[model samples]
Target chain A: MKYYIGVDGGGSNLRVALVDETMHLLREVVRGKANPNTLGIQQASDRIQQALREITEGFHEPIRAVGIGISGAPKAIAEKWLRDTVKAVLPFAEVVPSSDEEIALVGANGERRGVLVLSGTGSIAHGANDAGESLTIGGWGYLMGDKGSGYWLGMQALEAYIRHEDGTDTRPTSLVERVRQQCGFKDRFDIIPWLYQPAPDSSKVARLAPLVLEEAQAGDAHARHIVEEGAAELALLAQTIVRRLHITQPRYAFAGSLLTHPTPLAEALCRRLRLPAPPQPRYTPLIGAALLARLTVDPV
Target chain B: MKYYIGVDGGGSNLRVALVDETMHLLREVVRGKANPNTLGIQQASDRIQQALREITEGFHEPIRAVGIGISGAPKAIAEKWLRDTVKAVLPFAEVVPSSDEEIALVGANGERRGVLVLSGTGSIAHGANDAGESLTIGGWGYLMGDKGSGYWLGMQALEAYIRHEDGTDTRPTSLVERVRQQCGFKDRFDIIPWLYQPAPDSSKVARLAPLVLEEAQAGDAHARHIVEEGAAELALLAQTIVRRLHITQPRYAFAGSLLTHPTPLAEALCRRLRLPAPPQPRYTPLIGAALLARLTVDPV
Candidate 1:
């Protein structure tokens, strides 16, 4: 009997799983951030090794392969370094490494023949054609791009709040009060110190996306406009991928909190894309990593 | 003859000038950044005092009055602290402090009666009516507003560059190459580290604004679009001020590099606002600070 190990190394946290050849998750261990970009290579390697050792120590069976889906590890050098590091830990097993987004696409559809739009802290659209050729759009991070992302929504909300506070925006919005209540800010100037002092956190700002959605549901025109625009931006991302890949009636899998929420952002996105129905994700990206590991040793 | 010290305390640098009642700059000294928001109140005060002492060392005349225009001194507390600090340094001088925008308006129009649109690292529209009542429209800093400012333009250019880099945008732009050359960055991922590592500097990012202008002048459709959008946003700022203040075809004064540049951004702004002519600046903000000091002693 053979087992496999799969690791999901992301910006926020890391997850490692022990799985059987059938791609069933047997035991999983979660750790803090293990992205080599944020955490140094040594730290990331140590965390992955620790997870692998802990998960396999209880089970004496030799693992067939180890697969890792790391955020920001798509480049050749990054992949080589990561593969070498993972190989060092599980010397007997085959180590395969890929980008977090690629694994997400595989996880969403069980096969690489659909589009996956991940809209968590940042946003990206990933698609794979029937021939297994893959492409990505709009995962450029927060500084340059991340349209329709959590950070984008938060920024739009902040802009609306500031404009309203200034009494310059003729367009009415309840965002000032909503944001003030949400952020626990008593004065408008408080936002200035809050945003700049701590060196803006992407996740911290992304947390405000739900506030915008909530306000939109409550009938705030500005909030609704932001949601619509965010949906449109995200729809454009999906549309671009679909058109570029020449996929006919591609099935779209929704990922991240923006789509999973009770808000209309996802509905608006699907409507903008003119999809016939909502597509459900087949599995989580972690399970997708496990599936990829299964395919490494036992390709059918 | 009595001398007045005029201080223009900005985010990037500070300028101090010893002037007579005629508002002619005598000995002038430039120092490092002195915005109380960026530099603490103590450090900002020390820099301002150092510049004042350096400029007035050779001439031993008692300064009758001193005027200061600080970037973030509009708040009552900021103004009071600055005034107290200035008074402590110049015991015999009557100290007056105002927002940087107010002094810019006074400096550009030669009086406090017209609108001044400043589009530097940040942007704002400030105006003083005939009743000496002042109102401001869009000085909400970089995070919330400053639509047509250098920082805004630079961010737009970066967004365009990222979109083009991702192949998500069909519109061709030289921004990717132009920005790479300007920033001396060989890899695309370098921008992420450069931006978030040291806490993003608004001015450093703003330095890229000229590249967008250069690209636009060279006829890049994407760059041109960004410039046009920026111009329209700025025109809205000006229009808001005009309607709120009930100014009839108000003579508009332009301050800062966005408008001062040879690009069509300013012309576009003016055209959008339906302005017939560009209002010439009567004096620099330093002289405007001096004139404001003159007013402190001899208010009409």
Candidate 2:
């Protein structure tokens, strides 16, 4: 039986899985940060090897092909290292390394025509046409940009806290203390380090956005304002990507850390963009990569 | 000779003077931080006594009355305590002890009619009616509210630095690096202890606003934005004070830490107010207090 391998490398963790050509999950494995910036090429490659080995321990089935996806492999050097590394170790196979974004796009489209609005550690909106063109917006990072991401929303909440703390604020903002306690921050003293620290994962604090949103849902004006702003930006990104792909009437799907709940942010994105109820992806990005591997290898 | 004393007690230094009823300075003495919040009220009172003793040592003129300007001596209890303390030491005198704000107004107006804006270590705008009724706005405190104050502007600049340290930013934030270096923080590790260490004097950092304005005038957008925002707020405060006093045609003056030159915040304040000419105070707050001393003993 022909076997296929699929990899999804995230900012903080890596998830890999092996599947038969018929699409049954054979085995699964997990590892630490596999993004090249954090782990570098050598370490990422070593982790990949261990993941593949652990997943295929007992079986002697020859690996047919491998597909790997990364959160941000923006440069050519990163792609070259990934493709070469898999080829160097496997000895038996065809290897493909793509932006985790690319695999997510394919997964959302089901190899056809749909857009994927991603709001995870970062935020992005990308679409694939029958002719394969791409467009994006609002993924410029945290500063001088990034309007829709969790970090962007969190930063705004922090600004409100700061304004209130400094006394120039006419606006009543107990939200600062509310969020402070929620995030385990004792005072403004805790904020300076969080703002400057280069944590092992830049998205570590982003995980706190949902709690802030829940606060907003419970009628906190500041928290609600933050979520509303985030959603509006994400919606704009989706609209821009859809227009750029030239899909006059486009249907798209969204996935990522933001999809964990039917978040107010997600709800706002749909409402703002006027997007109808879109399908939510049932299978994980790894499952999508495995499906892609089966297609890329072709058939008899 | 009927001698009158005018004393300005500060956290850093105290300046006391023996002047004639005409408000001309005859003798002067200086001591250190008598505001007990910084040096304890007892030491502050002792410093006051020392400054008085040195100035009055060679005086044969009967000291008729004394006026002292002190921070933290708000309306009733604090004011009564300060007046009692000074009276106990120099019993043969009519003593008038009040807030630095009230004395600043009296000095700026020279025992006549006008408005005084105080922007010192903290910021507040206050005025007195011809009826002796007084009102104040802003200058709540460093933590509660002091919009357009030196400390407010300084905290705003710090927020900009925090943004730069987070890699999510793209703007040219070289100013943040320069400011951070001043505190000996190479990274976030040392920044923690340094930020939270005993009695963090956030005001020192605020003293950087004028420097920031200089940088802004030299084409730094961030600095310019900070100063401009502060200027706008100060102007608004001036307008608010005017509105409150129902002064249709008002003659106004300013005091405090932000009056320093070679910066845009003050310039912006003047420009936004559409002042056709520069308004420089003819006398300092001490002189203003002396005028108040003369008025308190005014034989109306």
Which 10 consecutive positions of candidate 2 chain B have the poorest summed lDDT? B161-170
The deviation in Å at residue B155 for candidate 1 is: 1.6
- Candidate 2: lDDT over CA atoms? 0.67
lDDT of each: 0.79, 0.67
Superposition error at A137 for model 1 (Å): 2.1
- TM-score for all predictions? 0.93, 0.56
Please list the residue runs of candidate 2 whose C-alpha ends up more than 4 Å from where it truly belongs after superposition: A75-77, A166-174, A183-207, A276-278, A296-300, B1-300
Clashing pairs in 2: A70-A100, A143-B168, A143-B169, A167-B145, B34-B44, B36-B40, B107-B288, B119-B256, B119-B257, B120-B257
Q: For residues B1-300, could you state the per-residue lDDT of candidate 1 as single tens digits?
A: 667888888546798888887776778888888877768888888888877778777677788888888887674557788778887778788888877877788888877778888898999888877766777777776766488899999888777766765667777678778987877777656677677666777888899999888888888888888889999888877777877878875767888878865567887787887876556689888888888888768776
> Model 1: residues >4 Å from true position, as ranges?
A75-77, B58-61, B184-188
Docking class of 1: medium
> What is model 1's DockQ versus the real complex?
0.59
Q: For residues B101-216, could you state the per-residue lDDT of candidate 2 as single tens digits?
A: 77776776675445666665577777666655665666655543355777776666665665454322348955676568666767533443454444446577567566576677
